[model samples]
Target: METMNVQEHWQNMALDQVPLALAGHEVPWVREARLAAFERFAARGFPTRRDEAWKYTDLSILAKRASFAPDNIPPDAPSEAALNAWMLSRQNVHLMVFVNGHYSPELSYPRNLGPGVQLESLAGMLDENAQLPPELFDAVHEHTVLDALNTAFTTDGAVLRLAPGTRLKTPVYLLYIASGYGVSIYPRNIILAGEGAEATVIEHYMGTLDAHNFTDAVTQLELASGVTIDHCKLVQEGSAAFHIAGVHARQKAGSRFVSHSFALGGKLVRNDITSSLDGPDCDCRMNGLYLLNGRQQADHHTCIDHQAPRGTSRECYRGVLDGASRGVFDGKVIVRPGAEKTDAHQSNRNLLLSRQAEVDTKPQLEIYADEVKCTHGATVGQLDEDSLFYMQSRGIDAETARSLLVYGFLNDVIERVPVSELRSRIVDMVLDRLPQGESIKELL
Candidate 1:
């Protein structure tokens, strides 16, 4: 397949909004960073469907079109009534709100909490910690072009750090609300947990307006010895949103990292998750659930690399596809040559509701170590016809029966989520959006 050059197109693409630097008087460092990122993006360009990793999802639609910049501030802060109407309300959580790519401290809640827990913005962290992580620019050499693309163009996101011996009872909510007005925005994030520290972090993405936006998000996680990090991510952007997210985790000896990803929005969404067990006795678990409807598309690609001995990793991801939506899952586990006694288990399953709904799943395992145990598998199908029929025979209508079966199928994974409030919230949202009418059978 021949690839077309999109740099010229991007350059000529008329943008309504420009960066803060170009929009007005600029900060030196901000201008420098923006210029550098633009050059990098120009050099690499967008990935085509021919690209092995992007074979199923194409960027042609994005490359050819000119998008508005991350500009536009709402006339007023979201009213309390408006916030109440939102699905994932920020009333309880320690919330941080971002409009476009800029932090809106006025809309954000107070960051009041116990010692050792720091909830701050990425810009602040970059200002204080001059030493940037090496992974920011060079981590993707191992594989994939999405990481490089995100790093090259990312603007602002959140920074979460848990100090040594600190335990956070409340989950930290990092909320990104995009009001692109038909523009594109990139969000970059970094999270760190010190030795023996424990915390549960919730990363939420929601849109307040209808925008043909593109979000290239990246999250880098570093865990020290004996630390436990529970990371929960929910992507519920608007229907017009295009989201590409990457999550990378590096774990030290005796540290445990648990991650759960929920994908429920965006026209085109992809999640690339990678975990490296670089220390012995490390344990990591990766779980994901994506429910797509209409013309939505969701892709999840994961890699678990065991670089040390006596490490264990487990992964399980389930997807629900309805209408003309599509879903993809590619999971790979690699055990290095010297990594002995490694145990890894993985599985991917999908449920399709409509005839047009489709899913493609691939689970791969590469082991060079003789002493490792690993397993992986994938399944794609619809609601069990027999189960639906059985329920329908018991006075349940077809739609109600289907909804019940779908809920039952997804409930197993929902139950595994660590946060009770968050889990319940997600469950209610999914149930509310189900295709069944007001039949008691579906509710049951």
Candidate 2:
């Protein structure tokens, strides 16, 4: 009898899912993509600590974990009453629900999108033989094994399209609920906005406390000239879950794109965001905040490419680490040779709340255009004792004052969120994690 090593185990896992993946996806090109991705993943396996991009994060435990593929999760959707706690307080938004990576139409709310708007699930479109993009899975970088796995085993996700001059009045909510432990979820979302199109999308991932699942998600977005899109990703997975997600956006001339990431809970998490400014006057803004306590860990990596003249990009990311948790931020900006007049700025700041907590922050700039203006900086520090003392002297208790300052540190990023209702929801979530948070509710 031969014992399979960790790498061999993962490769066999992907190999075993080949029949299921190819059987479910009927499109010729899609089937080819799945096989290609599966082969790549089976050959390379997961990234190791030596890989520069993944050097800071250790994924050794993933090899030892046993999990069921997306197709293996039972198709039973939970009752409406069981989802009350997970529903957003905002009642006017359009909704799409997924249970263990399978779309659930019965749980999804009905909505009337205006003319020139189309919304459909990935599975539904495939079943109906919809004309999908040949490059559906080609928009983002598939350098990591996590991405390869997602493409190989993606069960279901959302697809949104907006014709030229269309404007969506309400946000589209893509809620992914994890209910089965030892289950792996791969969700793939696609958004296409034509010229002068405008919309907002919210991607929320939540799960039960007992769920020890593995989630690998990816989203691809395309914006035409004069288009504007706002995207926010919220993660509240179980404490024992391992989650990895990526967002890739391509922008044309005069297009504006903004992204907000709020990472609140997970055993281990990683986020990757990349934006390509392919046309002049394109604008990209990214904001993120992560709060990690206990032994949790979260890593964020972002890149902005200025491929044309007059492109603009701005990024700000902050993290708060408590207990023995760890945080990492790596941001990069690149200006091509002809990308003159480009303006780019990036900043990463982290706060440590315990002696054992740690953070690794890096902000990088690679410029080939001489006329571009680019700047990047990173900071890692603890709470300012002086500021805390001043607040305590002003009749605020130590605990309340500390909580206020922590909230204040994150307020700037919260203020950048344009959706008011979502902003309030984020505030409430943050407050719940702070000590004596109820006492400072009035102050907010």
Candidate 3:
């Protein structure tokens, strides 16, 4: 049997099905844009190691072996017990669930959303002929093939809108679950926060362990002046799954945006986050943590663009790798011309718990303004032996001591999570996944 080239494989499986898949939903300009995006994907194919941005990660195996056929059949609604296990149970919060990229109304709780807030499915909105925002189907940047693919094939996801000056006391949960084997799913989400609005959002992705699934998701956020949003994303897909996700955010004057990302599962994962501070006095903060082991691979790329005067941005990402797993972090902060008084900082840190584990980290700062303050740095190393010894001297065994140290290292980022319930769940999840995790349970 001959192996198909990455470009040939995707062009045969995905590119040809765009038109028919979106047959009835095609408005003239929308259809044209989807076709154009498909053309772009066909021309560029997948990013290779030769590309500078992808130099530290490779997609050859995924492109050749992974499935590209769309999974149109929606899986059964999760049982009540299963839903309870997966949902973030709390008062005043709303939950929306999607199974294999299709909304499951039976499993979602859409009640009690106060005035000035709108929550609905993207597919539902399109079906009802609701006016869709132009940014919903557009690419946030011009440089990626995955974004083009997502734009061409996105079927269903959550859409959220908040009216001006509206403040929600509780967060909104968007849960995506993959159930079948050898399937591909694309989820697209759009969020619009009106002026002076305040809200929190959580996006959670999970899947069955036996499925050989591929998920490509995109999320776009538009924050108006004086708005503040706390956003968090958790990726806990199957260990055999391939996940690629992108988040693009634009902030207006006096707006504030904070992002938290957690990557705990998947065979091959790539996360891309880009934020643009386009108006004066805006601030952005990005933080992430990835736990990988057992031959897994995770790559994260982030870009922060300071386009206006008196803007500020900060980013910190941490990784913990064991067994033969690998990790990559590439972060860049840019201060454009005339963006004086800009303050930006970026850092990437990694912990290797096994001899075979490896990591590649790069932090960059590009400042065009003469009066800007910017700094970037990256570090890759193992846990401190002296600290482990200190714990061991306090009656803790070697394995327990190591686990405690590892948890302490990761807790730095976890502690910054603003939602108390979510933060507690994340802490428990991280401890349970660490090496010899059970031994440190009593200590926690």
Cα TM-score per model: 0.89, 0.95, 0.94
lDDT of 3 at 167: 95
* lDDT agreement of model 1 with the native: 0.76
Which 10 consecutive positions of candidate 1 have the poorest summed lDDT? Answer: 16-25
- Return the top candidate by lDDT: 2
Task: Quantify all predictions' global Cα lDDT against the true fold.
Answer: 0.76, 0.84, 0.83
Query: lDDT tens digits, residues 69-107, model 1?
Result: 444444345566765565345556777776666677887
Tens-place lDDT per residue, model 3, 165-240, is: 9997789999899887877888888889999999899999988666778898988889999999988999989988
Candidate 3: residue 292 lDDT (0-100)? 90
Residue pairs with backbone atoms closer than 3 Å in model 3 (clashes): none
Selected candidate, larger TM-score, 1 vs 2: 2
Pairs of colliding residues, candidate 2: none
| RMSD vs true structure, all candidates | 3.3, 2.4, 2.4
Q: Please give the TM-score that candidate 1 achieves against the real structure.
A: 0.89
Scored against the true structure, residue 82 in model 1 reaches a CA lDDT of: 61
Stretches of candidate 1 above 4 Å error? Answer: 1-38, 72-76, 87-91, 127-144, 437-444
Better of 2 and 3 by lDDT: 2
Displacement of residue 156 (Cα, Å) in model 1 is: 1.7
Candidates, ranked, lDDT: 2, 3, 1
